[model samples]
Target: MSSVNLMAREVAAKIVFYGPGLSGKTTTLRKVYETVRPAHRGEMMSIATEGDRTLFFDFLPVKVERVGDCSVRLALYTVPGQVFYNATRKLVLQGADGVVFVADSQAEAMDANRESLANLEENLLENGIRLDRFPLVMQWNKRDLDNVLSVEELRRELNPRGVPDFESAATSGRGVMDTLKTITRLVIKDLRAKRIVPPPRPAPPPPGSAPAGLEAQLAQHLHHRQPPATTPPASTGSTAAAISATPVPRTLTAPAPPRVEPAAVPVVSANTGSKVLGPTSALAPGDLFDHARAAEAAFIAGDYTTCVTACTDAVRRAMAFAGEGSLAQQAFLLHVDGSDLLRLQGLSTLPQLRVDDAAFALYVLMQVFVRLNAVGLPTAG
Candidate 1:
């Protein structure tokens, strides 16, 4: 998938441009690429394919006004406009905050235009991205051409939903900024409407713990108790040669310790369960991945205890990682973010979460391990 970043107060909205090849999908992108001042735009990226044709995608991070107490940004992207690159297109649309459909306005290209539009919907459906909910815009490009269809004809044949449409001669840069602004406005408007982004969440008073704080304690416990390394058996010589040569016996030896090694402390934060900082967050992308891998491993091994504990830990750490009004913090609201994850993980038996961590606080973690059927656990035998 492609990533685009736009900044407005604190929100980051990902907008994707979808359309047919040569329909100005790339041209619209090029226009945005050419129009936004260098300081305001991120580098443009295109994946080159056969015949010098390329798949277009871009990311721009720009901060707009502060909403409430924080600032937001958005990422803009364009799917490869080629028909055969549907796989890449579908992948790009995942997690898209909004979309802009760029259509060819020439009269003869109407069929290609229709097929491409239908493809967009189908691609969206295959990925479980709701076409209706995300902000959608339509642009009929190359309008400067002599044979271009009228806006009313374009509306009747395509864009029946009346999404905000633009007429553009991308080469000359007309309607480019307006289109960008329109999409940005729509993305923000949708986030506010869905209430996905939240207001700032304040941190709790700092705990007066030692250097071997909760996190340090956890790493010490896990690493210190790790099982001893095992050695592989030494390979014997050829059987016939061994028999004739009086069978030299050998003892297996453990592999040598690495010369330069990373500290053995655990990557999982005792404070932060999963880092709330998105791609640009405090924790590295690899660290977030490590947390996910660890949690999945624990869950798959029927170690729900560890999974529950880790989830709780993730919540706590997210507190510091997700800034005030960040989606990382605000979206943790039960029914929105954490609820579905917990239910999917078979932790629904747990009660409501404490605000301290993702759902890691004292109240939720305890119920995750407790079973309703285990009455009088000691007397069960």
Candidate 2:
């Protein structure tokens, strides 16, 4: 089953890569793990025979993106492809959100592929998901092998349902990312089609009290702060009716100024080894603090991308000025509700982020910045 953690605003789904033994399921998974940024993926684990044949399963956890304000994490597993491991495969297939049936393209392996496909259908049925309706993708692997069947021939035997399929040489990293991306898209789309329920929100916080911990500090810092008058106007991005500064679990509110781009703010991440944007000019810690305020304002006005970008700049600047492992960074990471410099490092690995996702990321990051600079920070208009 897909797990939705309301308090954390996180959604986790399971995806299984299934195939006959030596069909390249594990190889495909290894390719994906190698390609995904380290910060975005958990350690890979495999239980296999001494000969390297999978005896149980291979597991990798990947953080993909946000869906309707929930962070999506995928637990990718590859069942042992040998027929004797059918029980293990059936157990792993339980609650799967999607499947990638990797078929070895070698002509001689056609019987193995057909048997595995039939086994997959049986297991899926036992798990209460109709094979015909489940989110599935086929990977015609080992395409580079000289003794391989054509894609059409493989499709005729292994992919009669005409599920989306990919041709690949998993060992060489050929089409691996594309195959994974397609399956992810299909799983997300299927979840949406099934109308997976969003996690229930927490009750509203009391008036004038910050949402505990770092939020309290943030509210204190921005309590007397307000936006500047000369700020350029914005398109009125996704605005909430009111700003909630109370002690709620996930409060998102800030006073937005008219949207204008801030100076180039450069931020370097220690965790992910990525640079955050900021101003070129050497600014004091106080000056960078003001940028954090501006970021909050942008988030309030629904300029999430800018808000997140500015918040990154602010954190980086603060860290640089205060030095790494400073009180500021520690305080923010300890108390803030959403993303921090370290956590955002992994999210930055996401490719081609959408606007809402950017906004959500920024909104959370702003919270972190606010908490970090709550004590005696510079004020922004």
Instruction: Give per-model TM-scores.
Output: 0.49, 0.58
Clashes per candidate, residues 3 or more apart or on different chains: 29, 10
Best model per TM-score:
2
Query: Any runs in candidate 1 off by more than 4 Å, and if so which?
Result: 1-9, 50-52, 62-68, 200-381
Candidate 1 versus the native: TM-score? Answer: 0.49
Candidate 2: list runs displaced more than 4 Å. 197-381
lDDT of 2 by residue, 1-381 (tens): 787665346778999999999999999999999999997899999988987898888899999867665678999999998898899999899889999999999999999999999999998888777999999999999998899998899888887889999999999999888888898888888877776747433443555444555444554444333222333334455343123222233233434335545533324343455644333212234455457546545543445556656656655555443335864455544465323344554455554332344445555545544544554343455
lDDT of 1 by residue, 248-314 (tens): 2211112222221112222333344542322211222333344434443343222444555555554
Q: Model 2, 62: alpha-carbon shift in Å?
A: 1.0
